[model samples]
Target: MSSAGSKPALVASSSAASKRQAANSPGGHVDKRGRTQSNDEDDDEGNDTQPVSTRAWLSPILPSRNELITSPDDLATLLATLPGAEARVPDPQLTITRARHSIDSLLDRSETEASITAALERFIEAVRERSTERSRYPIALLAALPGCGKTRMCLEVMDRIVPAFCSQRHIPSLCLFLNFNSDAASTWRSYEESARHPQHAIARRLLQSYYGGAEITTNRDISVNAALSLIRRTEARRQQVLEQRLHIFIAMDGATRLVGAHVAPQFQEPDHAGLSLEQANRRFWKQALTDLQVACRSFTTPTWMLVAGTMSSALKQAVTNSRFFVLPVPLSPLRAVYAARLLDIADPKAPSSRLLPWRVNSKLMARIDQAAGLPRTLLHIIDPTTFLDTRSSVSIDDATLERVVRDGVQGSIMQHDSDFLESEALLIYRKQAPVFHPDISRVERPTTAPANLVMAAMMSTLHKLQGPDPNKAFDLWQSWEAFCAIITNLRILSAIAAHPNSEYVQVTNLFPGSTSSRLPEFFVNASAWRDYSEDNPDRRNQPVDGRVCLTPAGYTGVDSWCTVYVKDNNGEYTPATLALQAKLDQVEDCVPLSTQIEYIEKAQLNCPSSTTIVALLTTARMDKFDPSDVPPNAFILPRQGYKEFVACFELIADNVWAYNPHLSSIPRLASQFYGKGTTLAQARAIAEVVNASQSLDPKKQFRTIRDLRTYLEKHARVPNSGFTIQSIPKDAVLGWPYADDLVMEDSSITR
Candidate 1:
């Protein structure tokens, strides 16, 4: 449990500065950004302990079988003896919860725990063979949200599962763990230096440990060969070691540093020194990592590489663009039951030790659920310094627990906002003026939207809706209707909140809008029931469903115009100048839709943008709605035999921001919108893929788009859905009697 050298002065003091040390150092306090904060200026001059070697500090040697730390418990204990081990590894005393599946687990088990275990076993089998196929090697990227236990999972498999599997076959499994943010790796400027240097922080410890502290040299090839060579030489020493071959697993944590601004790039290649962080990342992944993986095949031993990092756009892009075969295993959030066990408030090992006030309490479960199944958030809530006295057996009331949980959730959200603000670099100008603003600089750019609070708000609403009281639970109609009413509002607000230039981004209502009433809260807030007038000159006189207005943080000038599309659609989607009409009652005729199209056509007049006007008509119930009655340039909701009104909000959410209107495929939209047996969970997956596809090249997306079209065409519901074109009256106007009162403004339900 101990290193040969003495500890550094970083965490040796009792002073306040010592407490601010980074999370990696023992006794170091983690800052709001999850980084260890240290005061390097304050040195512990009194310490006389011998300094640890550069190699040891940079790369800690992997623990061998001689240590007898084979189980997860043993590994956890060993980790605890190391500085900041608690921050890096999960406590073995707590139950290890399997991460949720990103895609529908019913269809794909590749991300499941069983799948990962099988993959690890396969790695061991590959190691046993003298000449294994390169594809047999496990090259995985364990991706997850911050605090979702990516590191813990890696350690568990490496330290416990892999070793156990290898032991049964009499094969030795060795792991060399590296953290990019470690003292050694952080100082590395270029990939070449990191890979080539004899004392390279990336792999020196791995070499020193396996070669018994021998001086390992690098060759003309990429530096991974040093470790690969060590494994190859193991065959010559097999008689002395008493093993057939070695299973070497290389795990790299904090890999996000390699791609993003986490590390200050010092390019060794002269031509690349001036490249941006993003460009540098792309090249590093496409070339450096690819070469490293390719070099792995040159060696004989079964060696797999597991790169772990927080899920981010930069990390995802790097992995996706890489030519290397890397299976990305994203960790899902913890379930409430598992989270409860972590808190020791439910399922205690001993019945006598279970606290009476908290043991399996429904209120406690509710409080834990507020964390949205994130273990880190739960840990924050249970942190004794912040929330509770875990040692206390005294009675704790529900109200106190509720407050603690609420505060923890809010704190997590605030931290997210703080991080977003620090990284955001755009100017927002609200759309207040009627005339199109000539200043192009004022236009708001598409940015990372703040989704934490929006999700938290949504979770809270869902919780209340499905609370203990049966009466509060939503019926089928209530669920779809309520969701449709406010989803657009939530989407727009979330986008504005994340925009760096938005003015007055604040949480006015915990639940921003409710669906109890007929009209959405957006219209109600403006004291109108049917529609609100947009400041844009072209649509100034037109009464629309609702509009979201956001001004730049410090300016009153308009930057972006987000016109809410509250109605239904046609084949192509041009989000700009689009209008949506929600039909709660049955659609008995096409007159209403015809009138709506005329109004939108009039609004499209003299439009400066190339984007065309589109309209979507949504209805929960429709009678005798003939395929021939549908209007051109318009789309009808619940196209015969489809009843997924609730899931369709995902489409609306994707297109809410009018600034970037990606003309998504109609077949793809329909596949997701009316795909039989689609659940809310599946809808979320579709939305994510749809959003991601927007950034990809059109040709690259052809496969996915074609697949979705195929699915839509083949589904049972497609047979009855007609596609005949119908033309509406050219003179149709917005003066239809029923349409006038379709959307009305009432302040009675205003908050």
Candidate 2:
């Protein structure tokens, strides 16, 4: 792709400055915060010739095909509006909408309590601290590849973070979270539009949840960039009180523009001179901090907040490390994690066999875990619930645990067929399937309507409403278009990996080369290309109108074929049937509860929530568990506050957090009482750091907080009023986690 002209963002460099440029340019480097480079990526060294757009490559990995109504049109609108001058119309068949949905689904399904709690703790500390020696970055960027738990982690964080202000009647403190979406990549909503505009929004209502009476300001003029501007400006008002103390945590999902955006605010654009395309598009992120400062200076008290965004590593690293903050959260023992959750959930029901850490027996499962490096994938992609259900009862036996590993791996593999089908279908839909495409007339087929009904319904809902996005109102990420694109794209990839001639598919015209072919081609080489014996003009490459077209096997009715027997056309359809039918001619009026629920949850976690979460929820008729019933930690309240008839209501907060105090975001006194083993580890790490930092004796300092404070005061600033008793990281000295991230040690790691 040619470098376009100047756009809105100011940060520069989509990837970090490194000798090893990230394999995925706009994502993160393999060695950075997001994305675990698959082995396949390493084996291929000369991939520079491929497309620069990660969306293009990753689009095919999704596995759905519901044609979203008006979604493509909305994307097209954005494409047209971005500052870059481009008549290069997006492929009408492009499933950008659905691609978004798929990503949201995968991310939403994989959240865990521990991951969520830790992120909140870290975020809260960032909000409270002002020191410079420590990394006091307000933007907590979590980047990862597909199936990684970054998005899930954000949800977990919101669970804690939102309540911070909510409990204080300052719920609107939650700021806007721009879903870093490709479809929306071209054009952005203004600060006001983003907060309450219909269509894939993620804030405002969240504020209402926390502030109770907070309403979407009817007179407000919020926009897409507003949240970012707010987050970037938050630091300026860190010490402000009242309205100022209310922070806006804008969780941007795909902050690919971080680098450029961050830099843009700092760029001194001559008042009369327009920024170059690069300056606006890529350089803005570096100045994001400045733009934010400029925008936020006018707020009442000034909103002190953070930008909690989910990005791929390449995208995350694009910003200059010296200018911004980045955090990499690696996957831990997932089996152990899942086992613990399952044990908790199971304990409430029946006698259960003790669940153990899931040790994989399958090479594929191990390979996958090693490649993705996240446990959420195992949970969602593998469908742990299904694995557990296979038992004679709900319990996971030793045999069941072993079997789960095998089944989960198989599930991941089975997904390829569907994955590829959706991918190729999207390619077909974009280039080969669009009725208006030059090649559309070449093949005489049934003409039902102008749009895919199911897709339309899905997209319509997504574009319908974005409430007070800042406040975590309905902070979900799934939308109709995003879901369709994700599922369809994934299906396409699955198909590509499974094709018999997968080796030669890429070079072939998108549609498989022959009618006899069961799968589409996957290779990108002419030398490896296999020619079809009986060439159908459509299947083989040919110039139609102007564009040369190859009908990829999964596209143009190949995968959209309806079953021979139609059960009923009354509009009621089974997913099995929908999966087999030709693409819908128009939007479906209703989506299933199960599908809608998934959509809402995903939307809650992605950018879609920014615009249309409430609509999505209303349309789906979805119900959120009472905040008190949700997992991890409930919003803590005095018993009198939560009185059920002043008698019947359960004290959910104590009930839930009591089970896993680790999940609580509030700094509970109990956490200070670490287990012996945990304490030992903590003490050891502290000792090492302190020893190195001060050359002090551990025994002497261990005697009293005063002695240690006196010793550290010589080299550090210890607050006079309060006494802190814990270890901390060197980074925490001025940045995050207040003083707790550091470990006091007789010998510190002189960071």
Candidate 3:
């Protein structure tokens, strides 16, 4: 779950090697059976469950297996998988790497960029029109999350696609690519000058790129006036050639620079300027676009601009959806298929199956998935220096894998830790520490600042939980462990909440302990057992009873919680703090939903912020359920819905311990727990089964929950046809005999 939205699912698979190597391999031809076979191997039917990863599955397809791969390092180097390395600039033809290496593929956003090529060509053509409407042509705005390959996509269009289009139309073209990032090949001094005179900075870049390193002795030649004069001079020169129109394509990398210090100057405009920084930035960029268009019109030279930037709030505010065509680059994690293909190109011999399958080793897969499919992060995680083991058969041990992942995650978090800290503190500050609450208070709020309040709440809670002669000193590791525990539980709750329609029972004890006495390991870290640290007993002899206050989730720190951006049906995401309370059925201590809502409302009264407080109450027994006890908006799961409930736990556990890459397609792992749609279907199905039962008892519908489940399974047995009951129309769902007959028929099929 990225801040942008839940990312598209990633497929994990493996391939033998790159296309060039595969093509030259001995006996690479297909056999009479139509399967690619080598001279050294005998033919065998491929496993359906574990399909071999082939380069044919790749976007810019590479061929099947390469026999050259011997180690993981070879694969990493071949793919140029290095963390923190920005996208490389492609050659003018866009068919090769900067190093002049022949490259037949662009993996990341090839489909999207290809699809938008026509639109880009139209934008260029529109700007090049001989009519006066050139001034109305807006600059193209490309938006994407960080590391989504925006720069690479923009470069492809400007350097390759546009040039091709111009050549086909017999138009002369010159492209000036301006990268404003500090480390880019841009003029860093000129970017600094943008603070005062941005137009001059643009003028200098234009002159610099146009001259191709020729000495422009005077500053006057690089001024705004000189830039327009140059355009006029070029247009007049081009007029000598009959019907030849000069098209100037300009691409601005890191367009976010336009909204920085340059925006303050725009705020001074009398009537047209906006009051806020975001509005000022928007107005400034729009004026910049208009100014460029107006300048181009002065010489009747056609010009088109492409601005690319990350999904920053300021960028979102500046680019109006109506005026400019906004293209969102998908930054989903690498799916199994992509991963498999990547491995194939990298090292064909490296064991990919162990790494790709979610169920194989979840903790390891989770770390790989946490890279969020960004090339930099993925490279960092699988970097040969840390990940690949050359000692024996390129195997990565548990200890080394743990360290590598921990370091990789640390590196990722460090990049955005400051932003995460600020956002998380803001969330807690907005909670306002309910007035008159037993543990929290208004006095705890700092008069001078809100940042310390988060720390205060954490420390305060830690002190209470410590019990008797507490360790007052801040232990960073202990604090971190507690934080992880809090985030893990909140994520579990959030996943369950996502599917309110589903109900689950039977909480599988994840840690090694007495199931009844011990809480989930995620809820109780080793630090919590302070007194018996050396022994580290599996479970405390005493009942696991206590309240644990936790901080709200943030973008960094905890991997599972970091990118889980769960949004409501209304398509709005409000970061939340979860409070969970549970009781055994014999305990009869379940809290009502209304009281929980009241507590939240009361807190909101003091500090009205977007932050939400979610409270969950669970019980071990379902037979004690009472209609009057359940609130109208609250969801209660009977024992009959226990399968779905347990599925939710399994989903969460898989993600944390062992992830099933196959289930990544599910929209919200939480909704699956709630049986959101599944609950309604189950209810209707059960009602249908019970109503149509042969029993004469009128209250058969009110039989024991177990009996109802039995009737449901016996009557409405879903066919094993790779489709859920939810996928079938309710009217078409037959009961008993019909369902049994369909199941039998489905079993006979080849599938």
Candidate 4:
């Protein structure tokens, strides 16, 4: 029905509140007093789903969450106390902030000029090694996306590193905080410098100290040009002071004293203050480093200069290989890391479901991860007060995410909007788009799982079904209606789901045709109609059908595509070919063994037999599938297949009874997916692989699926319990009689 790939999913969940409040509250609690959340308390159990603003989440984290010092005033005191080689309160990497703060205070506390003067004598003990000795500080360049907090972190560090003096008599040493942007700080300019105006307030304050009798008045606005002249006069004075104090001259330009301008020189005097033409051109690149070198050589006191910026391509040229060593801040999967780092502070009792779950889960995460290598989306899904009860643990369940992403991207070139394509896009984009596809999400499933073989053995039914199940249209429709109601107040599915307090579904009701209702009147916004996309995408001609399909450029401003990545049996990830998966499945929704093998061969995949079995089983069950240029075993199997498939597994184990290869502990594999693992799961994957081959029996090969799943949920490096399935019905599965006898539970899925 759809094309091989599709658009990146939409990200509508703003969580502006989530981002703003995630940083502090006392002991990990969020301050919810004045916050106005989009979802109301009534839906705390089963109703409202709306996308909140980003400021809700961002503002909290962005504000200084200095775990070291409780309050801003206490910060200085805490910094002055750090002692010895190392002392880590919680996280070790931040040990430097404590040390820098503590040591600077000791310098400021000096009573006598002798103590200040002897501070240089203390340098011998601190400089244990030269910059060249250890490449360990390979320039801690923190590579991150915009607004990921690098700049804020630099400011926090500077606040610790640069000491502020308390005495009025003391002229503080210059501590520069530079933004790679080529503009100078406005505060750096002096007032009254421009010919037409008065000076700035701050400039007047500084002038009071510089000149005793200067009484600057308030209210008169200084023109920018006038301020520039005064700033230049002061700059000239500073230059003279520099010449007087440390005579070994450093040349600079008359234009930009900083890095943007080239150095300029006076032609008449051989000993002129200005730089020559040759030096002028390169000064923009060299002044900061040159100054640091001079400060290091001439001053006894530790001269700490904190320089930060967006990592422009000009870095290689801007930084040099001299006496200075740049420390690199290791880049991490920060987006993914945020779940463990933030969002736990949501209020549990405050009517709103304390945390927001990505409508998509790990499978979605993997898909997005593979396709775009970023978690991004366009719709901002907001979840509030979802009830974890009998029918559904959460009102907005995983099936919705599966449908949205898999359908959204798998059918990239679909002639229609509702087409579902087989794709690996959602997982790739999940992390980057925090709201739509979160860095982390809660796994939702039923309480009990089906019996011993096929899917039951693996216990990944719900998790697996959230991806490719062919008979999911009914559920998708049900959920889609529920979604529309939550976002648009239709309540169509809610009425069917036995909502006693809710009104019936009606067009006028969804909009109320008036302003009295609080719900977002969906139809009221006529812009919601698909009129804009009724044209063809080729851009030149209309489609054969009277309707036209718009290109990405025409419909949406950006183009979204999918990239395929594969994990071998050894679990190494590499870019894989974008082959259609359905062809491999043989059945449109299922990947058959032969086709999988053929594609694997073409892609040169060298995976173990177990992975092959899982992949084959997983493929045959998809609503839409394509052969990934991937190994047969990489795909996790659907839970419903556990019993019948495990029967095959049992048969395979019989043949390979004595053919013991040095297999990694199967319990270890299970432990990776969940936590605990039974001995039966040890050979489960291998058994599944062998069972997938024609010769193996079903039971022997599939016995340990449940154990494998349990282990996976508990101990894998990145525990992905999403593969564990639990909610599917007996009749819908392949081995009906067996499923019926050992079924866990049945609801709308049973029929």
Q: By TM-score, who's the top model here? A: 3
Better of 2 and 4 by TM-score: 4
lDDT at 85 for candidate 4?
10
In terms of lDDT, the poorest run of 10 residues in model 1 is 742-751
Q: By lDDT, who's the top model here?
A: 1
How accurate locally, in lDDT, is each candidate? 0.35, 0.27, 0.34, 0.24
RMSD values, in order shown: 20.9, 29.2, 24.4, 27.1
C-alpha RMSD (angstroms) for model 1:
20.9
Where in model 3 is the C-alpha error above 4 Å? Answer: 1-104, 108-111, 124-137, 182-191, 194-196, 211-221, 228-244, 262-276, 279-290, 293-299, 319-336, 339-364, 384-654, 657-751
Candidate 3 local lDDT, 1-751, one digit each (tens): 0011221111113353233223322223343467754221211112211112332233122221222222222422322333321232211222112312122244545556654565556555565553334224545666544444556666666657777777777766656555554233343453355443344456555544443322222222133433533432333343333112456677666776555435333222332332455354454454333335333332244556666765454554455421333444333323333543343344333345534322222233344433333433334344434323111122222233223222222222222322222111110110111001111111122232433322332323322321111123221112322433332332333223233333321112211110122121122211222112222222222122121333243311111111112245675543332222221111112344454445434433322223322222222223434456543222333333332322212212122211121221222211121222344344444434343453323234222224434544555455542324443222212211112122322120001
Q: Model 4 lDDT vs. the true structure?
A: 0.24
Candidate 3, residue 628: how far the Cα is off, in Å: 7.8
lDDT of 4 at 527: 19
lDDT of 3 at 338: 50
Give me the overall lDDT of model 2. 0.27
Error of 4 at 183 (Å): 14
* Model 4 C-alpha lDDT per residue in residues 1-751, reported as the tens digit of each score: 0111221211213454223212211111111364442311112112222221232244343222112121212221222233321221111122222222211211111122232223222322232232323222222333332222334444333343223221222322322233322122222232222221111222332222222212333333322112222222233234343211211111111112132332222111122135445334333334223323323322222233233333322332243323234443322122322221122122122235423232112222222221111211211111122311211123223334333332322222222211111111112111122112222122332332332121111122222223212223222211211221122211212121222232221122211111121221111111121112322242322111111111123322111111123454665543322111111111112334455456435322322112111122221332333435334323323323322222211111111111111121233222222212222343243233322332222222222224233333333233331222331111222111112122312211111
- The TM-scores, one per candidate, come to 0.40, 0.27, 0.43, 0.28
